[model samples]
Target chain A: MSAEIEDLLKRYQNYPNVVGIIILDPFAIPIKTTMEYTLTVHYAALISTLTSKAAKMVTNLDASNELMNIRLRTKVHEVIVLPSENYIIIVVQNPGS
Target chain B: MSAEIEDLLKRYQNYPNVVGIIILDPFAIPIKTTMEYTLTVHYAALISTLTSKAAKMVTNLDASNELMNIRLRTKVHEVIVLPSENYIIIVVQNPGS
Candidate 1:
């Protein structure tokens, strides 16, 4: 599942007039959670800035609740607004222990 | 309403082995909100640090299932987990606009 998303992101690089592209692991992803879409937008911006691509605009992450999460519970925090999303994008740090 | 909480905080100085004392405005209060109690606890610590009082201990805010908000809505965002507190201690910044 995560691999497939990465593959799709890679395809973004082949198109002409494209910018840099990278995928984010929503699993245990670190986020302020309530920044609406800024975090995702920033991720795209970071990708373009670090790589050689003619991209200056960020394509939106269509995080309309339908494409977030569907499995995992305590491993996933309580879904903040299931009325909005089936799965949640939780904020987790890199496992250090 | 807010005045009462401040008065109670002032009385804390009279008790021995107290640290700092300060009240928070749940309204338009700047907080990370999800820190559970750290932000509130820090407020007390900061108060004790500056004030000359026999306080080195902190108390808890009795924020259980009550004593929150009851009226505001859009002025308030949708209640996150009303399965818990009726009035949420929203992470609001000091209103400047």
Candidate 2:
């Protein structure tokens, strides 16, 4: 599972301005990370909270629809969250690069 | 304000598979909508909640970093949330054209 995730994350590296990638469990525990910069567990926890809450919000509305991907962009960076059944994949990138 | 929002929404029509757009207040009240399909207020409320939570999460981590844009993509549609100081812009588009 880890190897497959690492491979998948490598594919995104080709994209422009991709700073880092992190895979977290539903509880926001960091399962894997490719961050060159420091990414604290607190950050991962908060991100997980955000992802889970968003997923729950969507699910509550329509059970037929599934939540696939989420992206948050700031002036300096863009955060993309892809939530699967068991894990969440987070990609941090530079916007407009 | 509504005219500016309408004009900005028109700009997004150029993008592929852009089905609709909605501008909501901080509380998720729909200020404007360009949806040809039915989009309930419940959907907007949940989306607003999601955006606000995510913004708060990011702010808790780094005060200097501002939350700018958030995009959530499902199998059928892509949801992009652009949050400003007073309002949140929600754009719904079809994936892969």
Give the lDDT of residue A46 in candidate 2. 78
Name the DockQ score for candidate 2. Answer: 0.72
lDDT (Cα, tens digit) per residue for candidate 2, span B2-66: 77777767877777878888887777788788763356476687887877788787777678887
Residue runs of model 2 more than 4 Å from their true location after superposition: A36-38, B36-38
lDDT tens readout by residue for model 2, A1-97: 8787777778777778888888877677787888733564766877888877777776776677777888888767888788877677887888873
In candidate 1, position A77 carries an lDDT of 21
Name the candidate that leads on DockQ. Answer: 2
Q: For candidate 1, give the lDDT of residue A44.
A: 30
lDDT computed for candidate 2: 0.77
lDDT of 1 by residue, B57-86 (tens): 001111121211111111212111111111
* Cα misplacement distance, residue A12 of candidate 1 (Å): 60
